[model samples]
Target chain A: MFLNLFLLLAAVLCAFQAIRARQMLAAALWLACTSAIVAWLLYALGAQEVAVIELSVGAGLVTILFVFGITIAGEEIQEVGSLVPWAVAGGIALALIGLVAWFVLPAQEASTAVSEPSFSVMVWENRGLDMLVQIGLIFAGVLGILGILAEKETAEEQARASQKTPTSTPPLPQPQVITTDAHQDTPIKEAHA
Target chain B: MSSELTITAVTVLCLLGVALYGLLIVRNLFQVIIALQILVKGALIALVLAGKISGQINLGQSLAVTVIVADTIVAVVGLALAVQVKRYTGSLDVKNLSTLRR
Candidate 1:
């Protein structure tokens, strides 16, 4: 019980740090830590299958994606604005929690002995459609990422082409010839007058 | 009240609250995605907890797995969008995304 409490507290702390970290990379790392802890919490809660998935996808894959985003987007430390928004958001969150508590506490006695089928049977037989849809969603996500990246490459190529184009240069000023003869100078001066 | 359930409930609530607050105030696109992940994690835990309470552990686990898969796709797509937004706007600020409407 104490260990569970410790893990939960650690998860919360990591999550807080992830939100408050000024550096995007640090935030991503903190998020990974939170995910890892959350996976452990899930394991403790008897959701071993979900725990493994969360560990790999949540902590592993998500962190890699975040780092990739940071590399491309270039991390900038965003300044925190006024506390008004934070306060307002906090109030709303508190109200939400209160509402949930009101609804959930009354149903605390609803817990029963778990007697479900094996995890594999549940996922393969019962949730087969969901699994198929998940596969489709992953495929769509991959296609979308490819399209976005391809567009980025095209934009970069266009920018490069524009840079490579030769700019028009202004014609050089004509050289002025000074005649040693006074006769030549007198005619030019007369023409100007 | 079962102490285990109470603890899990409180933890889930705190996670949701923190994520909601971050989502509300964070201006960075990356942070928005991070906040969303946090929110989903809270929900994931809640789902498992519900499953435990209702004595359908397998169903809860299956739903959580589905959520993980979907959340991963969301993270990937969101990051991809963030990259494109950065490419177009030259910054990761959410405020700059407003110019897209124009």
Candidate 2:
């Protein structure tokens, strides 16, 4: 029990750092730490299968994706906006959620049954439709990411082509005239004329 | 409620509050996505905890798995969009996206 509390506290701290960190890479790393802690918490809660999935997808894959995004986007260290209004709003919403959880969650009685089906049976038999939907969602996400990246590549190519155009077509060169004497006013006057 | 359950609930609330506050104040698109991820993580814990309390552990685990898959997709798509936005606008600030209105 004490260990669980410690892990939860650590997770919250990491999540707070992730939100408050100025460097994008640091923030992503902190988020990964939080995800790892959350996975541990899930394991303690008897959701071993979910815990493994969370560890891999949330802590591993998501962090890599965030790092890749940071590298591509580049970090912008803008001044944080005033937080007074946002804080107040968050506090109110949090209070509401707390009230709901307090009142509604404890009302459900825990089950006493000791025997339960295996995780595979639960997922494949009871949640088959959800699995199918998840497959579709994954496919859609891949296509969407591909489309977005492809558009970025095309935009970059167009920009490069536009930049190269001026260099490709050189400007006409002007003729240079050399003077033999500083006192040669006739040539200068003729040129001016 | 059990002490362990109470602690879990408090943790969930803290995560949710922090994520909400971050979402409200963060201007960078990446930070916004991070906040969303935090928010979902809190929901995932709450779902599992609810399952444990109500004696539907398998059901909760199955649902949590589904959520993880979905959340991953969200992160991927969000990151892809952030990259595109940065490429077009030269910055990751969400405010710059307002130019799209024009």
Report interface Cα RMSD per prediction: 1.8, 2.0
For residues B1-102, could you state the per-residue lDDT of candidate 1 as single tens digits? 477777887788889888988887788888889999999999999899888778787899999988998999999999999888887778878888887675
Can you give the TM-score per candidate against the true fold? 0.87, 0.86
Please write out the lDDT profile of model 2 over residues A138-176, one tens digit for every residue. Answer: 999999988987887897898899887886568666555
lDDT score for residue A95 of model 2: 81
Q: Residue A34 deviation, candidate 2, in Å? A: 0.6
TM-score (chain A only) of candidate 2: 0.78
Model 1: residues >4 Å from true position, as ranges? Answer: A80-84, A109-114, A164-193
Fnat, one value per model: 0.64, 0.69
Score residue A189 of candidate 2 by CA lDDT: 26
In model 1, which residue pairs have backbone atoms overlapping below 3 Å?
A: none
lDDT (C-alpha) at residue B38 in model 1: 94
Give a tens-digit lDDT track for model 1, residues A68-164: 8898778788775733488897888788878877786555545457667899999999899989999999999999989988887898899999788
